[model samples]
Target: MDDATRIELEAATFRRLVAHLRERTDVQNIDLMNLAGFCRNCLSKWYRAAAEERGLGLDDATAREIIYGMPYAEWKDRYQREASAEQQAAFVEAIRKPDA
Candidate 1:
């Protein structure tokens, strides 16, 4: 594919992923981090980084809002749950894995 087409496709895929995540509020970030090595926050950071690379001045809050479909604080207040001990241990182990 051409550069523009590839960019468009990537943007579309990102939007779909954000929409899916917004719909699945039951899936906690800690659980995602444990299983996938990244979560919404990581996506937000990557979004910010990509903006910077493109000379766009996007802040973390704006990037997170894009990913979370609202202000991250609001999402946390409504949907975030405290990680269980098992989840915490799994997260730590996942992080410690060299492949992760």
Candidate 2:
């Protein structure tokens, strides 16, 4: 595929992933960090970084809203749960993985 097509496809895939995450609110961030090593917050940071790369001054709040479909605080209030001890431990272990 040409570079433009590849970029378009990747952007589409990213949009779908964001939509999926917005739909799956029951999936807690801690659980995602434990299982997949990243969550919506990570994705937002990535989006923000990408925008910055293009000389676009996107703030954290806007980036998070784009990912969460709401303000980050609102999403936390609505969908986030307190992580269980096991989830916390798993997250710690996952983040500590060598060369990850």
Candidate 3:
């Protein structure tokens, strides 16, 4: 409940989420974006932003590698799929939703 404990718990949760996403390669980013309003790339961006806030000098590629558990281009080549029309439409709708 103290600040340090809260930070540790949040960091552990983030690591677990990243690990889960790494294990679930079949879950495409587009599907995540369509369904959840965010994706691995969003997480990568957030990670990079956090690093910048801490003066850690993390770049996009490094942030993406951390999030993807590998080089992003390699992950994309191996696991990423083209979004279906339905998926794209859903993503657009999700983005436009007031609460999203």
Candidate 4:
């Protein structure tokens, strides 16, 4: 595929992933971190950084709003849950694993 086509496909995939995450309200950020070592917050931060790299003045809240499909605080209030001990332990262990 041409570079432009590849970029378009990647962008579309990213949008789909974000949309899926937005719909998966039962999935918490901590759970994502424990399983994948990243979450919506990480994606938001990446979005913010990308914006800043392109000279846009995107802030964290707005970035998170894009990823979450709503304001972060509101989403947290509505769906965020306290991480369980097991989840926290797994997250720690996951973080400690050396990348191969």
Candidate 5:
């Protein structure tokens, strides 16, 4: 594939992933951290970093709004749940690993 086509495909895939995550609000960030080692906040940070690479200024709030489809605080108020002890332990264990 051409470089342009590859970039387009990758962008499309990213959009799909973001859309999926937006729709799956029941899936908490800690769950994502435990299973995939990243979460929506990670995506927001990556998005902000990418904009910086292009000489664009994007703040955390804007990047998170783009990812969450709302202000981060609003999303947290509406959908985020308190992590269970099991989830917190898993997150701690996951981060303690060398590869994680």
Candidate 6:
């Protein structure tokens, strides 16, 4: 496929992933970090960085809102829960090992 087609497909996939994450409110960021070593926050940071690369000024809060489909504080108040001991331990271990 051409570059434009590839870019379009990737953008569509990203949108779908963000939509899925928004729908799955029960899935906490810590859980995602423990499992995949990245979460919505990471995505937001990446989005912000990309915006900067293109001469845009996308702040953390705005990038997070884009990824969360709502304000970060509101999402946390509504859906975030305290991580369990096991979850915390897993996160630590996951971080110690490099991503595959």
What root-mean-square deviation over C-alphas does model 3 reach?
Answer: 1.1
For model 6 the local lDDT of residue 85 reads 97
The models' CA-based lDDT, in order, is 0.94, 0.92, 0.93, 0.95, 0.98, 0.96
Q: Write the per-residue lDDT of candidate 6 for residues 45-88, one digit (tens) a residue.
A: 99999999999999999999999999999999999999999999
Poorest 10 consecutive residues by lDDT, candidate 3: 91-100
List TM-score per model, in order: 0.93, 0.94, 0.94, 0.95, 0.98, 0.97
- Write model 5 residue lDDT over 1-100, tens digit each, in one string: 9999999999999999999999999999999999999999999999999999999999999999999999999999999999999999999999889972
How many collisions per candidate? 0, 0, 0, 0, 0, 0
**lDDT tens readout by residue for model 1, 14-47:** 8899899999999999988988888999999999
Model 6 TM-score is 0.97
Residue-level lDDT of model 3, residues 1-100, one tens digit each, is 8999999999999999999999999999999888778899999999999889998999999999999999999999999888889988988888888982
Comparing 4 and 6 by TM-score, which wins?
Answer: 6
Give the range of the ten consecutive residues with the poorest summed lDDT in model 4: 29-38
* Candidate 4: Cα lDDT at 15: 100
- Candidate 5 Cα outliers beyond 4 Å, as residue runs: none
Cα RMSD of all models vs. native, in order, equals 1.2, 1.0, 1.1, 0.8, 0.8, 0.9
What is the descending lDDT order?
5, 6, 4, 1, 3, 2
Better candidate by lDDT, 1 or 2: 1
Model 2, 18-46: lDDT tens digits are: 99999999999898877887899999999
- Residue pairs with backbone atoms closer than 3 Å in model 4 (clashes): none
Off by over 4 Å in 3: none
